[model samples]
Target: MRRAPIIAVVLALAVPSLARADIQPHKAIYDLVDEDGAATGGRVEYEILGNACDGWAVLQKIDIPKAGARVVTTNASWEAADGSAMRFHETTERDGQTVSRFRGQAASGSNGFAVFTDGEGGESFGQLPQGTLLPTLQTKTLLTQAKRDRSVLSSNKVFLGTSSEGALPLEITSVLSPRASTPGDHPELDGQPSWNVTSSFYEAGGRPDTGPDYTVRSIQFGNGVVQSMEITREGATARARLRSLDLYEVVECNR
Candidate 1:
């Protein structure tokens, strides 16, 4: 799921070319595509923020080409991608009551995050973790403990560890280019503006031994709302795509 976070970043686009000031809150649905430019039956949801923080929901399905028989939140981020001060609190319920809570703050160049999870028995933050410092292009960090994969925070750089056990090197695949606006009465259904974006990821950064080039196609906003995205290897047998079907308002934690 290395493409997960990058999908969120796609939704957060403050087009440097646009003259608009205030960004509208919106929700968008994206159509995922493969390397061959075919639909992959995947989707994403982007919740544009009214404040400094934005929200994302990702779903990759199975069994059916367009739907998932097994689905878990692959990843979620409630941070403002524009590098502003922000805070977020998230709660989940299984049968009725709250089962988890996540709260954090991001101020200018620095940010903090924490998570509290509750099982079927009860809720607790006993093992919750915390971190300080907002993730950035300069703050390249390893997100997973696995030795076979590499994921980083920067946009233009790919840092594969010294010991990787893969046939191909996973280099920086895509760098987001300028956005093209959405036209007509559609208004992107997500309230926020829409755009067409592309990223070019390399095989040399992590898969130096592999042949061919791979890229990702995405639609997003500056506040971190990814409408849709897809990932495909140059010549892989299967590629995955994600799309979002609906969007609704959630509770605001600032109160």
Candidate 2:
């Protein structure tokens, strides 16, 4: 137990055209189960590399199986082009050694963003208030505020410098559902047009009866693929489907 910062829920992403729509780099694979479904042996792979005119890269990996044979890995990465400027790193290993590590950088400070950190708890500096949003620009500002306020959107205050024992403050809540179609074993997500999201991660000023510490229910699509997800904490729940997906080939920026 005790390892629940909710894993940052592994971030989210995609739409294109309009200059490749903020972001759309892909490579995903998920299959983890718990909450009675079993199979907690572990699995999660993530990738979102480059685009949005140049600047985006994220890699994630998590494997679990600890006890006899031992195997626990958790890796993370992020490199930003402009999402308010960012650079982060993370690590955790077990059978292969290396226990913990973290590195950080955040910019865009006129009065709102400026954070710098160094691993295993060493250096630190923080201050994020004005419009604070980092972590792939807060998932592209929660899919453009859940597509222009279709319903419930407008609650953000994020900054996860991948933990240097510092930069911690997450409070995001975006909900918008009622336009769906696409889930027939994927089939390249059929026609698109999806939304049945439900994100909730709190701790920044946490209230609302101290409920959310982690929550994510997904469907996303509409370009930013999410396919399916269900992550809860405390009550214990874990699910992530969308076995495989790949789409990354868009580089046309000459302006």
Candidate 3:
């Protein structure tokens, strides 16, 4: 799953007509609840740093306390300034034991893109389709298209690699619409215009409706802040609410 839920999903929002300063660097916290309230004691934290001229840093941590299958997942990744390459590492711990870890990098290639991994369990190689996009660029594309007059955007390919197999391309289909907002603690976001973005993920090279691997629906604001998110898979859904938000001062790049 996109443990970063928000991280694996939302990134930068630099449209052609916008200035780079429009990029946002912030830290956010979300509390999670599964359908039926069957699971409690769950939380997700996300933070983003850097800019398009100096690469981007993202970190997400998810903790779920189940009776016996308690698990915590941490996802960290760095995308190159131009979105041409990226390095990612993920660690999953269960019941106090480090269960899995993956470290890898993907770069643009003559054909498309290539991925090499040497993690705790094994070593592997993977290839991304020619149109495949790294996470941040993928999100930028989502926001760009969402702002258009169209209501639905489909067939966008993105590589959201979470493990050694992270390079596999997933087709994305999104439905978007304008939304209203309410007053909130953070004035930067309070009463801001928002959009309802619902995206479905499907395996590449197949029919999307056969059954999407998963779907993500989020409340995205004009400034690119994802106020809340929900991820659904196998007919079950987990929801996360934005409980905290901190926008960082934009740092000028010396490069």
Q: Candidate 1 residues 64-135, lDDT tens each?
A: 132333222222334343433333333333334443433333343222222223233332221111222232
Error of 3 at 173 (Å): 0.9
Clashes of 1: 42
How many pairs of residues collide in model 3?
A: 1
What does candidate 2's lDDT look like per residue over 1-255, in tens digits?
Answer: 124224335443222222336345677776677655556666667777666656766767767666865445454545455566667666667788876665667664455554544344666666777777666666666556556665556577767665422555577776776565634647776765567778777765568576877777877775666766787777877776667888777565654
List of clashing residue pairs for candidate 2: 14-223, 14-224
Which residue runs does candidate 2 get wrong by more than 4 Å? 1-29, 32-42, 45-61, 64-91, 94-96, 103-121, 124-130, 134-144, 147-159, 163-180, 185-225, 228-255
Candidate 1 — worst ten consecutive residues by lDDT sum?
A: 160-169
Model 1 misplaced regions, further than 4 Å: 1-22, 31-43, 52-68, 80-155, 158-196, 202-214, 219-230, 234-255
Instruction: Sort by lDDT, best first.
Output: 3, 2, 1
**Model 1 root mean square deviation, Cα atoms:** 11.2
lDDT of each: 0.34, 0.61, 0.65
Best by lDDT: 3
Alpha-carbon runs more than 4 Å astray in model 3? 1-19, 35-39, 67-69, 116-118, 148-152, 184-186, 204-206, 253-255
Query: How would you encode candidate 3's per-residue C-alpha lDDT over 1-255 as one tens digit per residue?
Result: 223333344332211111344556788877786665443678777787886677778788888776778778887888876667888787778887887777777865446565545453566666776777766676666555666653546567776656422557677777778776666535678755567888877765657658777778877765556777777877877787777889898777766
